[model samples]
Target: MIAKIMGVLNVTPDSFSDGGQHFDIADAIQKAQCLIDQGADIIDIGGESTRPDAKPVSFKDELVRVIPVIKTLAETTDVPISIDTSKPEVMLQAVESGASMINDVCALRVNGALETASELGVDVCLMHMQGVPKNMQLSPVYDEVIEDIKHFFAGRIEACISAGISESKLILDPGFGFGKTYEHNLEILRCFDEFKSFGLPLLAGMSRKTMIGQMLGDRDVSTRVTGSVAGAIIAVQNGADIVRVHDVEETKDGLMVLGSVS
Candidate 1:
């Protein structure tokens, strides 16, 4: 099993979770080191906000927000850094600045993003998100979530392969809450095993999301730790290769127990 933990390292001051906490360079570096010590196999650094109905950040703003942080983290840790961006320029700059992976929400459809990641020789994770960030959850509709996302992944993977991206340098993520309704999210989560048809490592990122909040009806994000770990465990049991999470210590402990009992 490709068991691994991806720590959320947000450089944005407005992220849905842990925002503004790491906006300071010193704080971000400390948090990065702390996460590494806490057992994060990978550190995913993102500068932009992809929360529901979020506004877009400019390229210059994103670069300024992320480059220094990426450089700092890269120099300070041996863990691989994945740039969570959809912009081609951002990917190019991020990879050049030390990001070893491209964890795009848009799956490289933003013009030159595909070409850039293909040339960078780093890992790329193609994800399935319905619609754009600004309006994805605006009464989104799907005839069938599983089949639709599978099609999206197939097309994106084919495009990446055709664009000269290596086969071994790719991963897949079924973006859980990006554009899904409460029922849609749960359905996708429960039927996650159906995604195995794609034949690629799956990444699960359902930590502290709206779906969980809506599931429990009245839990705050901070208090959603149990729900998040439960979702992560379900994802693992369903065939996830990696899980991107925020509650690193709890998630690690949960996985250890799950492994032991298995």
Candidate 2:
């Protein structure tokens, strides 16, 4: 099957990429529509910036940032909406406002999050971050990256099941760049398929990330689109079921060519 493209919409002023680009309600709605028109299969909206060294937003602030956009899109479009947050309150509100999925960097490890996700009954993407965003990159260490992530997923999956979440509702993400060094990120991509051992859909999100920048001789974020597309294609080739990306149209075009050749 062709990998689905999940478009990123950050409604924050300090995101690593495109921050302040869609902080307004109208602007956020417009961006979501643009992503839909660009062939995005899923629209993942985030009110908080989980970028390294990023400060946290209060629950009220995050809700104010994302709910109006989600409500408007739910009323305007038929596209699936995914809330990119780990806060249980935000997850509950987003789903109520029309988000059909939860993309949590913390993998529902936050207090009350696992219970909230289980109750919401929406698809959940559990990402593996070695540590919190504020200091995750300081010195990320794992005996074996791939095996360690797999082990993490196994424990999270069990916890989700124990919390009354269906196994089928779970999606796995290796949390590229969240706490990984450049070498760690590359190693994850090289062995990304190993994540499929869980028998669940795998999501690969490496769009305009530092890894791509480092691979391209430390290119700036704006110039890393081509490299990001290449990473998406490679992930798909290695069995990624979905790719979370910022450049939806470019990734779609790359996937089209890949599909034709394969």
Candidate 3:
């Protein structure tokens, strides 16, 4: 029955979707407010583009792109802000700037990231990505996708706990498109409840992803709103506590309808 929505606000020029749309600080702020008005429970701000083949941005550049927006939103709205990054430095700065959650694609595998999150004392989402964004889609392989990611999450959770982070502060994301083929993504959705065995919150972010496109007639990113909402609905029904999404209003409406029925 959980239908928390974490609206994506990517402030990069090449984020695969709505990238350049929010590169300007004012525009990003406006978009954040729009997401908030649309019923986003959390505004997830990403500075760098993690899309496949995305060129890497310097740490300083990444910080510049996200910190101002986080600071502005923190001052203007009380909504929980999530910083989506893999770097330890960005995590620290984002928290200091008022981000309550760290949505890391690398699952804190980077050096010092676990310790940093522990020190910051914020909620952390550990996502399962097979490889880096640059080459993640290049022949990704897995003997059992769900089992593989479950093991990865277990190890990362252990690492976080070892680093003095409380277990209550952890969330898990299956990473629908980070490094998976169409079949792999579907399998994760089908077996999402198995991940809840850890008794932690589960976040599913299949919004406007290639998997949805591939499943729905190769629709373009902008034309995938219905598919994204469908995926979000399926994720929520399959034991997801949170649905990271772009079409917040549509997803919210869908969840409302679902709530009345079930």
| Candidate that scores best on TM-score | 2
* Residue-wise C-alpha lDDT for candidate 3, range 40-156, written one tens digit per residue: 999999999999888888879999999999999999999999999999999999999999999999999989898899999999999999989999999899998988998999999
Model 2 earns a TM-score of: 0.99
Score every model by TM-score: 0.97, 0.99, 0.99
- What is the clash count for each candidate, in the order shown? 0, 0, 0
Write candidate 1's Cα lDDT for 1-262 as tens digits. 2368999988888888788888887788788888989999999988898998788999898898888988988887789998999998899999898999999999999989988988898999888888998999998889988888888988888899999998789899989988888888898889998888877888999999988877778688888889998899999989888999988888998899889877
Q: Which candidate would rank higher by TM-score, 2 or 3?
A: 2
Model 2 regions lying over 4 Å from their true place: none
Looking at model 1, report the run of 10 residues with the lowest lDDT sum: 1-10
Candidate 2 — worst ten consecutive residues by lDDT sum? 1-10
* Candidate 1 vs candidate 3, lDDT winner: 3
RMSD of each: 1.2, 0.6, 0.8
Ranking by lDDT: 2, 3, 1
